[model samples]
Target: MDHDHDFEWRPGETLEVDGEAARTEASWFREVLGRYASGVTVVTTMTGTASGESPIGMTCQSFTSVSLDPPLVAFLPTRQSRAYAAIRRSGTFCVNLLAADQADVSDRMAGPSDDKFAGLAWHPAPGTGAPILDGVVGYVDCTVEAIHEAGDHVIVVGRVVDLATGEDTKPLVYHRGDYTTTG
Candidate 1:
């Protein structure tokens, strides 16, 4: 309820509600958070069709490891995310960590295209039916554990069921609206 300590208000830009500053512009929040560099990932899930199953995926940067002992991971997806909606129905998903060379994949997945898996080579994850993209730095296959509503995004907690890593691949990083590779 009290979010006064959650944000740093700009000078002369505070909104007071009963002597507490209200929420600020979403763009301002995004701009401030974009300064930090983050690794990129393609979160994928499978959706059943009239004939068979199909892959649905989206480029996501709001992903992180939550625990090692329990093998937990988390990603934030916007409420309007169609891929996430399919993932929720599937009850399983995979997070494919992108290599530096996979920026094209990231761009394609991040777009509004209906078929993000077009022209991409992928296989089903062993533990989950979610698509595991080729040429990624690593993959984390998981089952949906919990979901928490946070503003316009939903924080999805996943219990990792399987994982794998690729060799000699540089991670793709996003910083200040641009993509870069680590040294």
Candidate 2:
């Protein structure tokens, strides 16, 4: 298969691959890597204060700190995520590190709901004005620095403008398809 073109695989949908090699490899790769534990975050952005505009966000496990001096952070959002499209348009975002008690928030953001912020208490991060969820363990407010394409996701690098620790609580973690917290 040619690697020049793009490929996409959606959940519950089958791809018409030339052979099972690609499919099998994808499944095996996911299974093997699922064992590595990671903290969860909700990457959020607000496009505008217009009548119909609302905060957009998605729960992400692929978030990490990328630099310190010129402070940078990165998060991977699927290419097809509407939330990501909003983030790109806004050119700024907030990464809310979830607290262990906020699993419901994670599930809500991860779903296909049109309004993920419904019934959730949150305030805007001062730097970017993106929603900083109320019970998050911490948050990083940033402006988009760069974007790159990955397999099914796009890597977003943000230049940190502001940050702060929120409630003193254990971080929400995901591992092997389950939610857990550290001691």
Candidate 3:
């Protein structure tokens, strides 16, 4: 059974959901999606090496596993993120899945501070050299596989190079604009 055209749609054809416009107002979109809970992560990377090397990181909730056969993962980062710019330059990143008790760490990485890593305990991921933040639930170290434009964010596909889980811990979560955690 050839499924080549299973999802094909003609140009100029609009997609509708229950007669509602597929393109909703940005505020409404965000408001509705806010109801969904998501796990938190700090995406980290290193730029340069030795003496001048610096760590870059930003709190992210848009992360997911994309594949298993070849080991791939993805995260969406805003185009204007300074840390993302450095990650793009370095061509590698580590996604540190925040533990429930790491809300402070998340706040630190999410801010506009010049040094997000200040006072943070972490070590370099052996495969990518990206920071593996201490106390995280888990981490995924990867080399950038591909980047695709997605509205104001970029869909970054990373080929997993190394990954591991930390001590069993509940994950940090975000829902309706507040921090939460699994039971």
What lDDT score goes with residue 13 in model 1?
A: 21
Q: What's the lDDT for all of these models? A: 0.83, 0.84, 0.83
Better-scoring candidate (TM-score), 1 or 2: 2
Of 1 and 2, which scores higher on lDDT? 2
Q: Provide the global lDDT of candidate 1 against the true structure.
A: 0.83
Ranking by lDDT: 2, 1, 3
Q: What are the RMSD figures for all models against the true structure? A: 6.9, 4.1, 10.0
Q: State the lDDT at 133 in candidate 2.
A: 93
Clashing pairs in 1: none
lDDT of 1 by residue, 124-180 (tens): 999997999999999999999999999657999999999999647799998877899
Q: TM-score of every model? A: 0.85, 0.87, 0.84
Error of 2 at 86 (Å): 0.5
Task: Order the numbered candidates by TM-score, best leading.
Answer: 2, 1, 3
- Which segments of model 3 are wrong by more than 4 Å? 1-24, 49-51
Strongest candidate by TM-score: 2
Predicted candidate 2 versus true structure: per-residue lDDT over 1-183, tens digit per residue: 633222223221123434466657766776777789899899999866568668888888999999998999999887878888999999999999999999898889887787788889999899988999998899999999999999767999999999999999899998876899999
Which ten-residue region of model 1 has the weakest summed lDDT?
A: 8-17
